[model samples]
Structures are given as structure tokens and as C-alpha cells.
Target: MGHPLLRRRLLLSLPLAAATAGGLGFYILLERARQGTYNPQTFSNPLVGHRVPDFRLVGIDGKHGFGSSQLIASKKPILLNFFASWCVPCAGEAPYLDVISKSGVDIWGIAYQDKAKALAFYLAKYGDPYTRLATDPTGRTAINFGVYGVPESFLIAPGGIVRWHIAGPLVPPIINEQLRPELQKIA
Candidate 1:
């Protein structure tokens, strides 16, 4: 019923439309992949060269309270770790942190979004590496630190300046390679 030239043009246009649809779908998939890689779970703050936030919190020891001021008063560099018992990455870093603590780096830990009982159990199981353990019952302390999740560590100098911030898990190589050198400089 249609002219031969018109029929040929229609067939050509159909292939073009299909190619455009396929291209669009591929582009969307690529964009999704990029977004997935930028997930918050993989993100860490750039706290280096910034002053550490100071705040008072109830210590896990239940006998004494603690704040950033106490760490600054020590006149020695400090490592402040934010963790939670429920966080798998936090658990993974605990043993390595215990090793680091023995080096006299003045490590302090803040329990974020955790129950007191769970915190006690975690410390008991993993061995408390922190010289002072603070509990953030309502997660307010973590919010102040600009924390979106657990297993973050901040390196603070004697003057209370945050020298480094590591988000997510702290692997042994990271401690040995990245953290150790920075600590040596501060020490």
C-alpha cells in the first residue's frame, strides 16, 4: 500500500529509534554504577588540617567523665575513634587498635548509636583498646563530629587539631602505611 521509498525510510527510522533506546539504557546503567561507587558507606570525611570538635560525654567506665579538653591537656597526640558494637567494620579494626593503643598514642573511643549493655559486651569481647571510652547514647556526639556512620577515626595533635580522618574500616596496611607515618610526625 505504501511507496517503496517510503517503506525503506520507515524501516531505517525504526532501527534508529531502537539504537537510541539502547544507548539511553546503557547510559542509565553506567550512571547507576557510578552512583553505587559513591555510596556513603565508602565515604570518609576530610578532617585533616581541621580543629577537633570538643564535647563532654559520659564515659563507658561509669566512674569518670571525659571530653576533648582532657586529651588536649595531655599535651600529646591522640587518636579518637568513633565506633559501634553493631558495626562489623568497627569489630574488624578493634584488635589492630589494641596493638596501636599499646604504643602510648592516647587513644579514646566514642560509642555511637549503641546501647550501654552492648557496649560493655563489645569491650569485654574485643579487649578495650581505648584509654577512655565515651558513650553517645543518643548519637548527639557523633552528629557533632559530622559522623554519618561508625568505624571512623580521627587523629588529633597535641594542640587538638584533627590531622587525619579515616572513614569505614581501618585495615592493617592503612595503619602500618598511612596512620603510622602521620603518628610518627606528631610524636
Candidate 2:
């Protein structure tokens, strides 16, 4: 038989155990609700305000590649877009990116781990907005920029400094309100 003191202690701990369990359950429920309510798709990149390493980019031609100097020598700011043919959001943002390019913004497209043929098809369907295009077949460039997903854009200054980074689709409002002002400054 258990001692009376031990029995009493066990009974006293029951309420504390129940309270702890209830608190943990509540936390889990709140977390689930929070995640469900938010997009949860975007990631904040830590590379903002830093200079990206210079690398060669093949100018939409798989055979011939160009160095980073060509892009850096430009006076205007460059929009470096990382996208994949398989990403649905990339399709959604394609038109906006085209519009940005047409507005005299230099957009450099990096095909993130995508096949060149599929990339051509996607560009043909969505409209090619890139001033210069390249492919990152191994996603090494994406990893360097801390890209966890597709449809990420980095606004790079002429000196190769990464000024701003956006993680999702480049919608019209974002273009008009946020990007335009910053671009004006750089211009």
C-alpha cells in the first residue's frame, strides 16, 4: 500500500498537471490559428543592405555567358528576379514584371533550378520582361541570396548592393507605391 503522505501529494499534483496540459493545448491551438490566418509563404531575407557576390550570367543564351560587370556598369538600378517555371505565383507576377521592365527598369531574370525549354515556354506565355536572363540550374545563386521560394525580387543598386528584397508576387500596388518611390530615388 502507498504511504498516506505520498497519496496526498499525488492528489495535490493532479490540478497542477491538468493546468499545465491545458496551457500547452491552448498554445498549440493559438499557433495553428495564427498560421492559418496568415500567408506564411514569405520569408524575410537577411541580405538586405549588403553587396551580393558578383557572378557570370549567360544572356538568355545557354552557350554564351556574361560577367557581372555588364550589369554593374549601368547607371540605373537593377531588379533581380528569381523565378521558376513551375511556380504559379511567378506566372501571376510576370505581367507586372514586364510592365516594370517596359517602364525602363532593368530586370535581370534568374531561372531558379528550371529547365531552359520550360523557361522559354513560360516566358512566351507570360511575356518576357527581363532585360537580361540567366539560368541557375543548381539553385546556387538562389541559395546565395537566401531564397527559400520562388517569385523573389531584389532591388540592386548600380554598385551591386542589394537595396530591397520582396518575397512574393510583384503586384501593381507594390509596384506603384513601394517600388516606384525607391526607384525614383535611385534614378
Q: What clash pairs does model 2 have?
A: none
Per-model TM against the reference = 0.74, 0.74
Off by over 4 Å in 1: 1-46
lDDT of 1 at 31: 76
Off by over 4 Å in 2: 1-43, 59-67
Least well predicted 10-residue stretch by lDDT in candidate 1 = 32-41
As a whole number from 0 to 100, the lDDT of residue 33 in candidate 2 is: 46
lDDT of 2 by residue, 13-128 (tens): 99999999999988887784463322356556888888876677664554554446765676779999999999999999998898888888889888888887888899899998
What's the number of clashes in each of the models? 0, 0
Candidate 2, backbone clash total = 0
